[model samples]
Target: MSSKTYAGIPQEYAKLETSKIVLIPVPYDGTSTWQKGADKGPEAFLNASENMETYDIETATEVYQQGVFLADAVTENSSPEAMVEAVHKTTKHFIKKNKFVTLFGGEHSISIGSIRAFNECFDNLTVLHIDAHADLRKSYQGSACNHACAVYEASQTTNLIQVGIRSMDVKETTVLDPEKTYFAHELATNEFWIDSAIDQMTDNVFITFDLDAFDPSILPSTGTPEPGGLFWYETLDFLKKVFTEKNVVGFDIVELCPNKIEKSSDFLAAKLYYKMLSYKFMGENVEDDYDNTYESKAQKNNVTKFNDDEY
Candidate 1:
């Protein structure tokens, strides 16, 4: 299938209707240690998105109908501190218009700037971090604002809840609050308390997802792959619950390194973006959009099969 571009002007900004959501693509990856091409992630995801049917199967809504705008990619190269200032200025412009921000990242470090912007508009914000590593180090490779310390910088802004974490160094362990950190092993083995973990979140949430939070089996294109992380449905179920229980104001999806050999990773990331949009905005009305297509037929057939199996 051919790649899809957003339905607006190229590179500057594209708006649909009143523009409740804006996608800011940050294609800068100077500090990545292992993988080098994550700077190309935004374009790859956008290209893959062209083939995605706008309708969501689970939510049953065309979330794109909510009006998504794509902002130009931030391509500046400077110190992490300077980059944060640039992101802050740009994000503050959007926040002034009351638009919800969805940041597409070059690496996890990009979130530091975005979250800094968020703290200005929100007071009781809590971060929901989905990552393979704890990322709680105070500094890494001589930079305090390194990608490895993204979560650490975020915690300075607000309370944090980290999930799907499977790796951490001894230094990270010392700084992190044991109560707020949930390891992937705990989530996989103890399914009964996922709700309890999510319940600890504040009413206003900022979700930051590192692609490595997913099992390397499904998403192997990240810079640092970790095994035994979340599966698709498991992570989605948790997100659904979080959306239902809390008010998610903004979010970021980071660390996607598009590999030509396995294009599924890019497509999956694109689909996940739409799914989150559907859940956040359409809610129960998600299934209402299915009045006109094969999707409705498929959903009905699945429902019928499920009912028949119950007997």
Candidate 2:
């Protein structure tokens, strides 16, 4: 094993058994529309993550105190369906171990498998989809598994609450629930959008965040860049509320297409990943967090407590 892992933390804290969270990197770049460099997204995100401070100032907690096991990135293949299946199985593996799993991706289409795994694990799942594009097409270019159909299965099976959506196909409107879908144009002056979005969710939520949800100025390293997207603080505020008010089962951040000139986007992805972990664990701390045998401590403190049915 390479000694390096997420947060640049010591190996003891980054090992699987002792950690409360797992970082699954899926560097699979398939079905991208505009950019082709998304295959390097996970690497750039992890490289930037190594430089981040473990302590999250906004959440007032050193979230990395809860050990974070950064697993090896998922192996890429020519077949996109095979890649998604791999992600689905791997994500479910860690979740069964009672780990708080999160994934960073190569493209928006990569979310389909992760979402499927979360659906099987948790009941009454409310998918909080934060993306610039609706991604509700029944099929794109002959594949329902395309980036355009990222949330198609979720919309059919779960309570899908889409937010920060600024782009959509004319046909997508047919499947999209207007009451639950919060559009970026309509939200320019609405402060209650966040509250209403969360209200539409169930107790267990799975977030599928497409990086293009952010404005191109703030986050240009994405497969598709949108003109007017979410800002840093506004996005974080909504996320914090969601983490605080609901049970975030798991999440995946996808669609980062890295570049050499714009390294800030890479850093942003890393910081965003850490910040999400911090918010999720802010109020769920356990005992002996730094101990070598911390899994027992976690159970003792009821930190990672959950029945199979609750998953």
lDDT of predicted model 1: 0.77
Clashes of each: 2, 2
Candidate 1 positional error at 65, Å:
0.7
lDDT of all the models against the reference?
A: 0.77, 0.86
| Candidate 2 Cα misplacement greater than 4 A, ranges | 286-311
Number of the top TM-score candidate: 2
C-alpha TM-score for every candidate: 0.86, 0.92
Summing lDDT over every window of 10 consecutive residues in candidate 1, give the lowest-scoring window: 302-311
Residue 87, candidate 2: how far off, in angstroms?
A: 0.7
lDDT of 1 by residue, 1-311 (tens): 11223632233224533556788888878678897878888888887787788767787777766567887778776887676667767775665455668888788888888887776666667899989999888888988768888888777778899998889998787778878888888876776657877778877788999999999898888888999988999888999888878878789898999898999889888877877888888663423442323244324322112221221
lDDT of 2 by residue, 197-280 (tens): 888898888999998999999998887898989999999999999999998988999988999999999999999988998888
The positional error of residue 102 in candidate 1, measured at the CA in angstroms, is 0.4
What is the alpha-carbon lDDT for the whole of candidate 2? 0.86
